[model samples]
Target: MIETEAWVLYERSGGSESALDSDDFRRETFAFPGPAGDELLVEPLFGSWEGNMTHSLQRRPIDICKQRGERRVVIGNGSVLRVLRAGADVRGIHEGDVGILHGGHVQDEFGYTVLVQGYDAPGTVGVLAKRTKIAARNFLPLPLESHHRLEQWAAFSVRYLTAWSNYHLALGAYRLQVNEPLDPAPFVLGWGGGSTLAALDLARRAGCRAAMVSGSPQRLAELARMGIVGIDRRAFAGLEFDEGRYASDPEYHAAYRAAERAFLAAVHDWTGGRGAAIVFDYIGAPVFRASVKALGRQGVLATAGWLLGMQTTVNRAIECIGRHVHVHSHYIRRADSPKAMRYAEREGWMPQVSEIYSWEEIGGLARAAAAGRLRSYFPVYRVNPV
Candidate 1:
């Protein structure tokens, strides 16, 4: 057994720790058994804490539905690494192979589970303790040209896949099967957060006019540079933009919903009275109602995350039955990594990484995420331990 240190999270006595101090994360050397079968020991190069990773580490209900036996490492997606050792049966990847690790865990109704690589440590190197049957699907090979941009590739891997799958496969496929051929006249509306940027890119590629809903001035400027329109979520909802008030005050929410008529009217005007063809929203309750209202006839709303809040008050009669709108829920899958990587290479697009840090800086990064202060579209960490 080889001993390597990794960061692990432990459940508290009663409720989970809400605030992130230095004590929440720990680095301990663990004994790892050598690969015996189809497994390949991979040393993660760079990783990022995106939606699931951030939520699992700092969001409320930190221990929601978690049992005593759950995995200690609270990581999710985005790992670009080199393979160290490979078992004889492993076919798709070999020693010294450079690839991105995908997914957190996959499970079926019968309890068959596959824990894809997680960003729990995000900085330290460790052996994959689980089985390796899923590696064939999860490991996506990166081209030699992308080696120098490991941080960029690591940051883009999961976000690109999530956005690509939601837009290209989920929303795009639905449109082709149901109504139109997804023509150039269609408008694509993307909500806030990391996935929105990628979805906007895909929408533009698909010959649609892509627009984003964001409140940050820097983000708006960035979007303009990319030739995408930016709609301030606060201005769109007719609410004075204040992140703190929006979170704590119920009146702002009610007012925001009341201003939906204005928002929908603007959407109609933007689309020449046709409304949007597709709306991408992973934020769940906060913007879901507006997403539903922003759609045109037979439009699709694609979703993956519910970070703001899960439960939303939706009037099914008007939103669904009346408009014939479709709600498609998709989770990131291992196969998406390769598809997105190929698309990125072909399109000459790379991830927008803002910063890179060593593994020890992960705690500070986590604290920033918890405080709602992380501004980088993607922040990645290198796994080099002293």
Candidate 2:
């Protein structure tokens, strides 16, 4: 006999005298002693339907158990009413709570019984809770190391969204099926600092190389610090542009075009005519066509934001047939996967956070993103330890 520390309550058919021999009465009749040595059992009652009897029994198991002086009670879904009626030593459990009703299945907010330890909120009866597995530990707060590990794991799992989003685009362009090994050479592109770094880290994990085209020197330097090889205007000759001169000259537009052509030529040479697997294309339309034109057999162009403008055209059918290129645009959502956090921690790719700000400084961070002054940037919320 598999003896367990739990109790059941139910009714029997016929009168009280006939109940003992009835199958329904025997099935509904069960008892167990509490840890404090109190015997508990369901009252002798009968009902027309099994469902109704089970429902009633769930609601009153605790009450019936308490009448027997059982303070330490374990109630199943059907016995909620009895537990509520007994109302003896009732205290909710938390995610990391140990002892008491540990390893037991309880209902959450949604009325689903799951193996959850924590109470999400007070006064939430019959509501199911999120399920989490727990290990043996004395009733106490999680250790600092454990807390930090959980935080980092949660962060990385949440931040991996950017990588998965980009990967989706690449997968579609390559006409690859799920579970198929991707040819990493034709599917990786490094764009903005965060996304680029995230993509590069993902590429490394996927066993592929990545190409980065940075508009700012600081960005290139940051990538270098992350051990990502990058190419910029400074690396090549005869492809320089004077920002001041271009801004003032009568033929500024013409000079800009010439400079763009030179830059494109350098890119083409760098790729050895095979073209890039992915292009960041942050400089917008001026370089948009060049980026598309520079794609390898199955390259994807993922744009985070259009800084220049959103107007661009391509011969859809021809572009698809000739270069087999895919275009994808996206912006990061606040909730990302924890893969990103893990990558940041594992690779030490921490964003060179320009400033740490309190909640009051949110406006400043917004202004910086608007003015495009933040470097390798991200806004972090400040919370008190308490």
- Alpha-carbon TM-score of each model against the true structure: 0.83, 0.49
Clashing pairs in 1: 75-120, 76-119
Candidate 1 wrong stretches, greater than 4 Å: 59-65, 68-71, 104-116, 119-137, 177-183, 236-254, 257-262, 320-323
Q: Which ten residues in a row have the lowest lDDT in candidate 2?
A: 39-48
On residues 112-190, what C-alpha lDDT tens digit does candidate 1 reach at each position? 2233344332322222221122243456788877533777777777677777667765555456645454454478888
> Candidate 2: which stretches are off by over 4 Å?
1-160, 175-187, 233-253, 282-286, 327-354, 381-383
What TM value does model 1 have?
0.83
Q: What C-alpha lDDT, on a 0 to 100 scale, does residue 202 get in candidate 1?
A: 77
- Model 2 lDDT per residue over 41-74, tens place: 1110100111112222332221322333332222
